[model samples]
Target: MAEPFPLAPSLWATTAPPGPETPPLTESGQADVVIVGGGFCGLSTALHLAERGIRPVVLEAREVGFGGSGRNGGQVIPGLKYDPADLVAKFGPERGERLARFAGSTADTVFDLIARHAMDVPHRRAGWIQGAHTEAGLAEVARRAEQWAGLGAPTRVLDRSETARLLGTERYLGGWLDGRGGAIQPLSYARGLARAALKAGAAIHGQTPVTGLSRSGSTWTVTTAQGARLSTERVVLCTNGYTGGLWPGLAQTVIAANSFQVATKPLSDNLRRSILPEGQVSSDTRKLLLYFRLDHTGRLLMGGRGPFREPRTPRDWAHLERIVGKLFPQLDGTAFDHRWCGRVAITQDYLPHLHEPAPGLLIDIGCQGRGVGLQSTMGRAIAQYIATGDADSLPLPLTPIAPLPMHAFHRLYVSAIIAWYRLSDGGIR
Candidate 1:
C-alpha cells in the first residue's frame, strides 16, 4: 500500500491540527446513503446529510484528506474558469446564471462551514488576487473585475504599480482582487469536516477502498478491499482525480493532472511584510498558471503545473523553487521546507459535472483546481438533492458521464500543451 501519507512531509502535515479517529471498515454495513472517497466533497456531503437526519456511510481508500483536499495550494478561490457572461452564453441565461451565481458564492460556503462548525482549521479571508502576466491577461482580469463588481462583489482592478505594491513583485502588468476569496489550512479543514460529519452522526471508514460497485435489485452493493460490503439505496462517488475503475469509463471523463508545490521556511517579519502583507492569496492568469499564498506562520507556498504524474525526486520541484526566487529575489536563499504534488481533475468542459448514469448512482468530477471552495458548495447542493428528491434544487445541472475522446494519450498531449504554455508564459519566470 502507498503510505497513508506521502513520504516527503508537507507544510500542512507538519503544522495542521490533529485529525480525528477514522478506523477502517472491517465489517459489512448498511446505510441510507453511501459516499465513496473522503475528500472535501464526501465529508461535506456526509455533514450536510447528517444535518438533514440522513446518516451517510463514507468509505475512503486511504485517510480523509488523502487526495487533493489535503494537498492543494490552499487558495479558496471562487468561480469556474469561464466568466459569468461566457457561462450565460454556454448554458444559456437561465441555468447558466444559476451556475454562475452558485460558482460565485463557493468561497462563502467554505468560510461559513468553518465558522458554523467552529472548526480548528487555520484560515484567513483577506482576499484573492489574479495577477495579469500580459496585456491580454490584463484585459481578462479587467473583464472579470467588471462582471463580478456588477454582481455586487467587492472586486477591484489594480494597475501595474498597485499590483507590484500588493504582490511584492513587478512581474505582473496588472491584476484584480476578489474580497470573497481567501486561504486556509486545507488538510486541517478536511479533517475538521470529517470530525463535523462524525459528530453529526455520519460513519466514516478510512483505509477501506471500495473495490467495485454493483447493482443487486433496487439496492447498490459497495464492496470494499477488505471484503466488507455496504448496501444502500443511493451511492455517491466523490472521487475526483484519484478516481479509478470503481466505475468503468468514469476516470476517463477527466484528466488527472499533477500539481507540484513547494513551501519555504517561515520568512522573517520584514520579508513577510514585503510579500502579501495583507494575507491575500494570488494566482496569475497565465496559460500555465502559478498560485501562491502565505501560511498562518508566514511560510510562502507556491504551486503550479508539474510532471503529469507524482513527482519522483527533488528535481521535480526545481522549476518552482527557481520561480519563487525570481518572483521574490529577497527570498533567493530561503530554504524550502517541503515539496509535494497532487492531482487536479480537469474536465473536458472546464466545468464541474454532476452525472447520474444509473438510478441510485451519482458522480461529481472536474474540480479544475478550485475544489476547495467549489466542492464544498457542490456537496451541499448534492446533499440537498438527495434529501429532497428535487433535481431542480441542484445548483449544477446533471449531465451524462461521457468519457473524453482520445483519453489514453491525454498525458502526452497535456505535457506538450504545458510546455507550449510555459514558452508562451515566458518560460517559467
Candidate 2:
C-alpha cells in the first residue's frame, strides 16, 4: 500500500488570509439541519440555510477547507466537465437547459457571494481559457464554444495565434474562452465562507469526524468520533472525494482520483508579465489534464493527475515540472516551493451527484475537479431544497444513490484507467 499522504502546507495555506478559528463540537447539540463536512459544499449549505433562518450545525474532520476545497487549482470554471450538448443528450431538452443555465451561473454565484459577504480573498474575473492540446482538441473547443454560445453563454473561440498569445505558449492548436469565469484564492474563499456562515448563525465544528449516522422517527442522530452527537431533522453529507465508509455505499458511488499541484516561488516581474499576461486561468484538453494559474503573490501553480497511490515523496511532481519546463523554457530552472495532492471524486456520468437514499439524508458529491465554483453553487441549491422541500428547484435531480458494481476493485480499476489515460495523453501530445 502507498504510504498515507496527509494534507501538506500549500501555497494557499501560507499566503491566503487566515480565517476565524471555530471550536469543535464538545457536547451533544441540536439544530434544524446538521451538515457533515466543512469544505465548500458544507460551509455554503450552512450559510444559505442560516440565511433562511435555519440554524445549521456543520461538522468537519479537520479544519475548514482542508480537503479539495482549499487544495484545488482555484479556477472558477463556468460549466461541467461535459459540454452543453452532452447535457442535452443525457437529460433531454428541459432538464438539460436548466442544468446548463445553472452551470453557467456558477461563476456569478461565487463572485456575488464574495462581494455580498465583503470577503477579502484575492480574486480576479479576467476570464477562463480551455486550451486545445491536440489537433482534435481544437475541434472539441470550438464545438463547446458554439454549443454554449447558442445557449447564451459568454463563450468565444480563439484561433491558434490568439490562444498562443493568451497562454504564452504554442502548445495548443486553439481554445475557447468563457468570459464569465475567473479565479480566486481557494483556501481564502473557503475560510471566508466559514466566517460568513458563522456570522449568519451557523455552528461550525472542526476536528469532529462523524462516526455513525442513524435515524429515529423524523430526527437523525449523528455520532462523532469525539463522543459528541447532534440530532437534527435533516442531514447533508458534503464529504466528496475524501468520503469514507461513514455512510454505507456512499464512497462506492464515485471513483476518487488524486490531483497534484506544484507552485513556484514568486517569479520576477518580467517573467510574470511575459507569462499568462492577461491573468486568465487555464486548463488544457487532455485525458491527463493540465490546469494552471497565477496566484496573488505571482506564484505559478501547475496541476495535473497524480499517482493513484499516495505520493511517497515530493519527487512525484517531477512530471509536472517537466511540463512546466517544456511549456515555458524561460522558467526551466524555476524552483518549486510547494507540492501537494488532493482527491477529487468522479462520477460515472461525469455529472455532480445529488443523492437522497433515505428521508432527511442528502448528499452532494463528485465534483470532477470543478468543485471551486460548482460546490458553493450546489450548496445553496441544496439549502433551497431543504428549506422548501422542492426537488424540481434543484439543478440536478435528487436521485437514489447507485453504488458502482464490483466497487471492491475500484482502486485497481482506477489504477488501470489512469495508466490508459497517461498513454492516451502521450498520443495527444
Runs in model 1 lying further than 4 Å from the true structure:
1-6
User: Model 2, which residues run further than 4 Å from truth?
Assistant: 1-5, 426-429
Alpha-carbon lDDT, every model: 0.92, 0.89
Q: For model 2, what is the C-alpha lDDT against the true structure?
A: 0.89
Clashing pairs in 1: none
lDDT of 1 by residue, 266-366 (tens): 89999999998888999999888999999998899999998896677788889999999999888989999899888899998898889998999989998
In the order shown, the candidates' Cα RMSDs to the true structure are 1.4, 1.9
Error of 1 at 422 (Å): 1.8
Worst ten in a row by lDDT for model 2: 1-10
Worst 10 residues of 1 by lDDT: 1-10
